[model samples]
Target chain A: MTMPSTPRPGGRSARIQAAVHQAVRELQKEQERAELTVPAIANRADVTPSTIYRRWGDLAQLLADVAIEQLQPDQPPADTGSLQGDLRAWLIEYFEEMSSAPGRAMLRDVLGTPGHANAGKCDGFLRQQIEAINERALARQEVPIDPEKVIQIVVAPLLYRILFANDTPTTQAVEALFERLTMPTKT
Target chain B: MTMPSTPRPGGRSARIQAAVHQAVRELQKEQERAELTVPAIANRADVTPSTIYRRWGDLAQLLADVAIEQLQPDQPPADTGSLQGDLRAWLIEYFEEMSSAPGRAMLRDVLGTPGHANAGKCDGFLRQQIEAINERALARQEVPIDPEKVIQIVVAPLLYRILFANDTPTTQAVEALFERLTMPTKT
Candidate 1:
């Protein structure tokens, strides 16, 4: 059978999208504690297997899209008017989302998926959302650092802990990350 | 029917392992720009389907183990008598490896697979390896940074560019990352 096409529109399509996303979230919650599958999610969501495969291209892509949709738009980390303040605020928000149970679960799934590098469009959606905040930090010029690099510095450990070690991102870990990132070196 | 079990004898086991790894690698190369599957690999390797399924525990796990086996052992950064020097050297090596065509391609595949997180024990092996290096860096006081945070500082941009943004990790990116991590901030 042919796979369904992208989540395109009519009233029915939007409704399906909503249902699928909700199903994805619920499945993700289950995923946090156990395993998940399209058939299982379909049974729960009451959508057919053809409906999922046809619309989303694949299970991972669908979930990544749904997860991206769930991410809150990046905010201009508090205007503490300092790079450190901005970074702290930015990272706190970023990590809080990442460290949350759902976020952690989603990340674990994303990194665990094979052939993820080819999923560039989805990754771009997430990165751009992050980069916008980094750009804001750059405009402030309170800290003389590359905005992209700063974003990477702040977010990397949280992702690593969640995906690899299955550990929570602690405050001490965050603080240390911040300090080392900002310390001067022989640039 | 039960999956194929491991080879029965020592020499046979080694032969089986070598054949499996070779098959997996060749399959990866063949599917460099497309999707890969167990049947395709089995056909190419001239192995029975049961043998592949039994030994690798499915495609993702099999591939993850192959990738993990391919990773080089981490080397201590040259003791240039300074944390920055040592860290720079170490990270440069990391940056180089992660940016290499094969490295990026393989990683993308690892991240691309849906349900990749369930890949037996090899799912997070690479990240754990990176974490180990971070721990070593801390113990050696080579970077004088908190050990835990070091993983994020070094890896975030590398993976972000490779996995998310579709950019090859570059010397400039590594240098910029180094600067961000080394800059002084409000202690």
Candidate 2:
């Protein structure tokens, strides 16, 4: 558990990792989470269970490694006319995706991973998305708000509700957060 | 994982559950998390491994049940007169406790549990703590903010930091959040 999860692999390692990851993704689509043990994944991946244990430390770490990769945005955040528009659009998408059944499972994998490295890597995706939007805002001559503040104001609450609260978070809640963040402060 | 975790029990069930839970708590102290197999726990509890699996489904559910119970405050949140004072003191202490190593593991257990029932139960504790503080505020004739909003503003951020962020949250950060929450609104 103290060992670092190889979330990102390279060169020769990528081949084995990809096979194992693909096995995980397909199995996740096909069966129950309780059935997703290390031996099952290793068998499907054509590798020994010892390989999984040696590389990922355990099943949770392996799932986390796969989840962190999948959760990454395939492309950068789309540009909108205004920073407000861009941020709102991005957050709405983020919230909806994370609230979906499959998305929640991915979230559980990353957060449940005992080593925080995978979680930290996932955090980077949010910052990157925000930065992309902020860069566009700066280009448009609008003052860019800090990414950390956006994370605190929006992402935290959405995730908290998604994982812990019995009720699902509504898209309107994300909108409300965006409005609250963008509205001019009274002096 | 699909079955409900026996987070609380009544009558005769309590005796066996207590034995199992106490064994888990003690074993957690003595061994690595990876070494805590159902057989080991059952052996310590003086029950068969089948008993552990039959009752709890898996180690995650059993661990989650224990975690949610330990998270419950032994006493109610202390009254510090005003809602602001009470909330600030309460959140600061909460932030510290939850950020501790053992606290993070407990949080992981609750969040990682597949059923989500345990996680929801843990959420109730936060809401209950807030209600206690707000009741005191009402007695003093001071307006009490929504408990949900307090959770949204403070608890969400603190937990996001504790569970996901690479760095730990600071007491000063809690104070800053409290100030923002209590600050006068500009029209």
Candidate 3:
């Protein structure tokens, strides 16, 4: 079962994938992901079920593809010069995106879908985003922070609030997370 | 709607609630919460759907009640006497419970259910548990820590790993979380 990261650029295949993804999102807005059917998505996308089956193998794979595509940052991480500023900006952007309708829908699809090991796939995407920001921090000569530590301290709490508590992290909470991570401590 | 903190005292009502809660957990073990229907649950519990509706109003409320019941601690907090010891013991207990099949099932039911405001319900339950622990810490004369901060630092990270990352927090990681929370910090 192959999972295409993105649609092939400027071709018939690209158009098909785009339509399929759009159809999936629209269906998701109206119904639960588990209620989504391959034939229904194909009918909406104006493609054959066989085409979808051959491409994505099943609903889980198709939804994963759409979720990943939606989660990709619109642009590279902004250079905010300091590690604290950069981390704060990245996290706030992430929080805002995750609290939006599309982002929550994507998360619900990936997470709520049963029998799908989409969590590992989503974690990889999240780690890559953090690594990119860390690279920028390193470039600015800041002491490199542990990515795992960062995930536990910053990302995990925010995500817990988003997914489990269904609460949006306030700006103060976001800044507190950044401060707790970046502040120098007396061991 | 009156949400009983505990199942009503020994009587027909208690027996019914117990049977229904058991049926809910069994169904959750076999399938996702969203797929659970009132008829199926009623059949399993040997009660009529109207009975469930009368007591809980709907599937969401019934599931919420079951989830809350499963999450409530049976015993009072263990007093390890010291703040560090108490925190460590409490966290380890929580981690083990959350990593269990039943705990994960309850979480999936609360989180995976669409359009359910179960998050707030779960959060309140969690906060009550934390307060009970904090009360013990206060009795031992340790300065009371913020329950929300404890959640963000200790609980959220472990839960995020369990739910999203699918990675179990190691013993060292758990200890690190407790230490981070209890250690005196320079503000």
On lDDT, the leading prediction is 2
Q: For candidate 3, lDDT tens digit of each residue in B4-75?
A: 556668978888888998998888779854468899999999999999988886675677678767776777
Count clashing residue pairs in model 2.
0
- Which residue pairs clash in candidate 2? none
The superposed Cα distance between candidate 2 and the true structure at residue B97, in angstroms, equals 0.7
Better of 2 and 3 by lDDT: 2
Question: What are the per-residue Cα lDDT tens digits for candidate 3 across A1-187?
Answer: 6655555698888899889999998998888554689999999999999999999876756876788677766666677876667667888888888877667767765664443366667777777776777677677666656778778888888887887677777888788887777542222
Give model 3's DockQ, 2 decimals. 0.41
Per-residue lDDT of B73-187 in model 1, one digit per residue for the tens? 5444555554566566767777688777777655644543434242222334444544555556566654346444455566655766666565677777787767757522223
Across residues A1-187, which tens digit of lDDT does each residue of candidate 1 receive?
Answer: 1223354566688778888889878877666433667788788888998888887666666766666566635443466665566667667667777777667545544554445432355455445554554566567653345555554765655665655555577777777667757532222
lDDT: worst 10-residue window of model 3 chain A: A178-187
Judging by TM-score against the true structure, name the best candidate: 2
Give me the displacement of residue A128 in model 2, in angstroms: 0.9
Instruction: Report how far residue A109 has shifted in candidate 1, in Å.
Output: 3.5
